[model samples]
Target: MPQIKSLDELRNLRQQVERDISTRRHTGTTIIVGMGTCGIAAGARDTMHAILEELRKREIDANVTTVGCIGMCAKEPLVDVEQAGQPRVTYGNVTPDMVPRMIEEHLVKGQVVEEWVVGRLQSS
Candidate 1:
């Protein structure tokens, strides 16, 4: 760390942080939906759409992405949310109707919707 020479430097650093937050909002998050063959057949596409719509409705910007199975093909239509320093929470067998509720209960409220999470078949 450099020595604090003048108040201007501190002000500049704070300004930079504020800018980063705004940028962060635009780059909000990485929301991954499993679209593996089984997942797609099960309805992951709809789940992805629902998630995007919910985020839009809530005015929360996020970078939504899709990927092949996490090897839990039985739990199709799985959704994962990863925020720095927080454990990844994965929702399985999700439906369009459940998106809003999931957002409210999980993303916004900081609560995991256990009923929707895949069975704890694996340890972190």
Candidate 2:
């Protein structure tokens, strides 16, 4: 954290924090990528980069995160999408080429790509 040198700076910092909090509250879409050893070996890093690029190109506000192994070694390069009021959907064998269509159908059109889905978990 940087030192707040002036009142205006403090006010600006507060406003920035408030905006970040508001964004988190409103944008309920979260994209979780598996970055475990098996996942990386299966090209998860490329998938993650593709995801971020697609999100940026579409100007979508999403919370992209990562996780370790989920015990599904066969299903490496797993990507999970969780949105408000919807079940978390996990897609297996995700590659960079599939990112655009996934984001388009899932995030933009509000439809899950059922064909690529490997798991689904309903939120409580």
Q: Pick the candidate with the highest lDDT.
A: 2
| Candidate 2 Cα deviation (angstroms), residue 26 | 4.0
User: Per-residue alpha-carbon lDDT of model 1 for 44-104, expressed as tens digits?
Assistant: 9999999999999999767799999778888788888776556777888788899999888
- Tens digits of per-residue lDDT, candidate 2, 32-119, equal 9999999999999999999999989988889899999998889889999999889999999999999999999999999899999999
Looking at model 1, the pairs that clash are none
Error of 2 at 11 (Å): 11
Worst 10 residues of 2 by lDDT: 19-28
List the candidate 1 regions with Cα displacement exceeding 4 Å.
1-27, 119-124
The lDDT of model 1 is: 0.81
* lDDT for 117 (candidate 2): 98
After superposition on all CA atoms, what RMSD does each candidate show versus the true structure?
10.9, 5.0
TM-score of 2: 0.84
TM-score of each: 0.72, 0.84
Per-model C-alpha lDDT, please?
A: 0.81, 0.92
lDDT of 2 at 53: 95
Q: Which candidate is the best by TM-score?
A: 2
- Candidate 1 is scored at a TM of 0.72
